[model samples]
Target: MFAPTINSLVRYYHTFKFSHLDAAIVFFSFFQNMNF
Candidate 1:
């Protein structure tokens, strides 16, 4: 019952973490481009 919800939440957390890292990398590259 509750197990499915917990599993989904855990998966979502991992996805969010990866997305956050991706955003950071993109932002860093954009900043470098602006500086150049």
Candidate 2:
């Protein structure tokens, strides 16, 4: 009965995880550029 809700939650979690990683990478690179 709760399968659909669980599936959507997992999907959202993965998407958020990836986007967060991408944002981190971008911020890191920008910071490095500023340091130079």
Candidate 3:
């Protein structure tokens, strides 16, 4: 049913949350390099 979909979404959310900071840093640096 929808349980598997919900579980996968939850896991993906947690992984994204943990990597959020790192992702932001990398994203900003990438843009900065492009701008310069």
lDDT (C-alpha) at residue 36 in model 2: 100
Instruction: Judging by TM-score against the true structure, name the best candidate.
Output: 2
For model 3, the run of ten residues with the poorest summed lDDT: 1-10
TM-score for candidate 2, residues paired by index = 0.49
Instruction: Report the lDDT tens digits of candidate 1 across residue range 1-36.
Output: 557755764576577764777666755765577689
Provide the lDDT at 5 for model 3: 54
Local distance difference test values of all predictions, in order: 0.63, 0.63, 0.63
Off by more than 4 A, model 3 = 1-18
- lDDT (10s digit) by residue, model 3, range 1-36: 557755764576577774777656755665577678
Clashing residue pairs in candidate 3, if any? none
Q: Decide which is better by TM-score, 1 or 2.
A: 2
lDDT of 2: 0.63
